[model samples]
Target chain A: MTSTHDADGDLAVRTAGLTKRFRSGQVAVDGLDLAVPRGAVYGFLGPNGSGKTTTIRMLLGLAHPTAGRAWLLGSPMPDAAARVLPRVGALVEGPAFHPYLSGRANLARLDAGDATADPRTSRRRADAALDRVGLSAAATKPYRQYSLGMKQRLGLAAALLQPRDLLVLDEPTNGLDPQGTREVRHLVRELADGGATVLVSSHLLAEIEQVCTHVGIMSRGRLLLQGERAALTEREAARLAVTTRAGQADAAAEVLRGLGLADVARDGRALPGGAGTARLTAALGPTPPEKVSAALVHAGVDLVGLEVDRPSLEQVFVELTGEGFDVAR
Target chain B: MSRAEVLDGPGAGLPVAAPAPVAFARLLRSELRLVLGRRRNLVLLAGLALVPVVIGTVLLVTRDSALSGQGPAFLAQVTGNGLFLVVAALFLCLPFLLPLCIGIASGDAVAGEASAGTLRYLLVVPVPRTRLLLVKALAALTFAAAAVLAVAVTGLLVGAAFFGVQDVVLLSGSTVPVGEGVVRVAGIVAYVGLSLTGLVAVGLFFSTLTEVPVGAMAATVVVAVVSTVLDSLPQLSAIHPGLLTHHWFDFAEFLRVQVDWGVVGSGLAVQAAWVAVFGSLAWARFTTADVTS
Candidate 1:
């Protein structure tokens, strides 16, 4: 992991030891360290009750973190936010559009420093963004007429009105159905590909797993894990499942001991059953596949089948958080 | 540089170029848009339009001989009655309503966005909280000016159209010509603008304190109502002039023939003082607020 203050393209966002404690003494965010590279779609993933929203607020200078510092687009928190803010666009929390205004007008009002952008230009941008988010037909409709998924899309269009370098979206697909979810996912990918550093925080682990190149899991006011998806998976041990003959179970176990290949355990228990008419699982911690196979053959174990299992990010998350994972809807 | 040269120097462009005409102005402009862009703002404007027509119709239908003693002619009655009624409308009715409007206008000024979740969006734009409050307060001031202007202009035109010209008599027994009365009324209109600053500041302060737009607006109005009631007390005459609620109605006294700058000036001073105090509180609160909905 490259740890540096100044990254590139204005460094997008940086926070060090950021902490926020509510007046009621509940620590919302504690000792958080976040660094988002410019133009990289950084997905912020955490279970509910995590400090995702708090961290987002602190980064935007919306809420003052109790301790530590934050920098956005190279400016310090609350101090340099004005100069840095115009260049960034964001959609935080609920879709709070003026219910009376049309979808297009709502985005028009939110567009910063676009006062000189010809009304026609604004209209075109609003229309295009709305269309991109699959809300083109709903442009003229009142915001109150919009459904939750539609509102989420409208909020996104509002955020994308001006070509901002960074997008801070909180649960962008919160109320979206499968189709709406796909649209947002595609939009996020395209935004990152277009060189905009995207920070999307959500409780949806599956969404983060599918699209995020870099992931940060926050839990209980702390950042539990953050890294490239592949690297975190690589750190875990590889497992192989095998079935054997019952007659040579004990003899195979002795042969495996002679060959020093009997270190594999079943269900985390000591290797009690040998090559019986039973299934056996083995662990290979960062070892080459060829070596494991050779050790099995040399031990004369009746190997019926050998298959390598790749653990999903979901499994790793469940193991790390010590909770039942939510089945992604 | 001499003060004269500084005054005469390139309007806003100076030797060093002053920082963005008024940081508060842009903030104010945005805040104004927040108010004006809403449908409720148009409704408020429409409501103000009816004041002149409604008051005019009532006078036409009633044509009471009793009202003639209150004022001599149509313009006198209209402008005279209009000034007081407008003051009542702006100060009393609006305190209860407009502050709420302003409170609603600005109520969500920060919190609305926070609650709606757009506050973070605005903040991420890196707008300083001070700038945000300044802009929002300024916007409310503009609307305050607009609300007062709406009543003054509409009421005067309707009064003139229906009643014709009438010499205005001040409380001091000095007579002001119809034309001069118009000018003074304009001045009074301007004064109303200044007077409203205190109320707007109060609304702005409440705006900073809460995320609920209605709550902020209602609180300012409640405070205004309570203060107005206290100021109206017969025993508090000595201290009444100091309360902003007392000064908001002082404009009617401007209709007097020999303009009493003493009372007017004091009223203006008191209102300005309230503005400074509330404005400071708003500034401090906004600058230090966490603003997380």
Candidate 2:
């Protein structure tokens, strides 16, 4: 993260050493410095136990941090919360609403709470938002009767009640069917195209990988990486896979180990050469393929085939946090 | 409204979203609807309204029996003129039922939203924590006033039906026309409503301390119960005047021929003190609270 010395109007969300320590002495978010550029689809990626929601809450002034400060839309919070929050829309920790209130009434109620929302246009705008989320049919159904997907759509409608410049959505696609998830992805892109900076948090990389312009990876209460999506994934080296006799797989691993590959390991994947074949996978790092092949042959390990594969963001996450994510479904 | 006009820092020199009065009125109206429109809350108010009807029915049926003059003084007071039933019912409900109704309504003020998980959304709507608290407290207070009037108005109707409305006899032995008597009944309702504001504040403060509405409701009712219990102990007379329920029954002074404004003023003063202390405490706890739920 860049130093927060410059007050960049280009940045929509900025936090400096933002931390949250609960009364029980557990640190939920540790010294997080977030810089989300204007109009970018920023994905905040973290596992379930990570503090993604906590960080989002702190940013939105719903949760107070124990130390440090934050600014939203170029003003300090929560001193500026009354002034700034009206311009930003958010959906955090999934959908919550009055059980007895209908989906339309719920959106209308939320719009009424927005100072910037014109009371005369509130019902119209709420209906429009419901249409936008494809929940118009169930608009009059009581919230308690909504299916999980419908409830999520209402939450999105509430967040879109006013034309906001920034949208902070935490796991917006949660509880969505594949069709609904696709719609959410499409809607996000549509919103991003409309010039609103979208800060979306998710544990699934593939969910955001398609549309995210920038990505911030967080694990165990700390930010591990933050930058343009291309650069983050490009920084990870390609993987080297070697196929050989099952008996020589350990020797090929030893050879790759000798070549300074920290991730050298045997693969459980099926190999081309019938019964006795085996595969070994390792990070290619800076090593040349010829040296790997020569080392394997020099060690009497016959190389049937060798291939170099580009690393996935999942591998990048594993490399950084030493823990795997529940892959995107 | 334009986004740029939605006001930011004071130094922005931009137009605010709307006039302060307009925004506050809108917010307060919305809160009142949310609080009073709920079916459960309507049930609570209806329950209070029925108390007077039940009392009036019992007294009307037993007036011919030896049971007359056997119950509380207000019960006997109802026989002479039905207008006194308003006073009788208000007096009967004050100790437990009135506080319980308000407790259920006001106790759920903040905690209800928290438990429903809507508190975070409201706060982030940028309603300003202090303003949100003000709206919640006002909504609950409105519910409280409604609860008081429910019993009084219903009592008046049942009294008129049972014993027939007539001129009221003051405790000091002066007679007043039925119209004047109703005016005093209104006065009693207003005073009873004022007496409960302190409890409203207490409920709000407790509401902010937890996410469980039932817990807040119980705590609020318990506070009233304990205060009433303590007020009855002669040995604790030193703290009687300062207790929440101390001045509750003092609304009887409103029934006097020449109202003692001093006693009325002191009762209101006690309520004001409680509101001031508890209101500020609620604001303090709520404004700085982290809305994790």
The top-ranked prediction according to lDDT is 2
lDDT of 2 by residue, B39-155 (tens): 998998899899889988988888889888677757788877888888989898999999999999888999999999999888888787888899899999999999998998898
Q: To one decimal, what is the Cα RMSD in angstroms of model 2 from the true structure? A: 6.1
Deviating ranges (above 4 Å) for candidate 2: A1-6, A239-308, A326-329, B1-16
Error of 1 at B121 (Å): 1.8
Report the CA-based lDDT of candidate 2 relative to the real structure.
0.87
Query: Which lDDT values do the candidates have, in the order given?
Result: 0.68, 0.87
TM-score, per-candidate, Cα-based: 0.81, 0.87
TM-score of chain B only, all predictions? Answer: 0.80, 0.93
DockQ of each: 0.26, 0.35
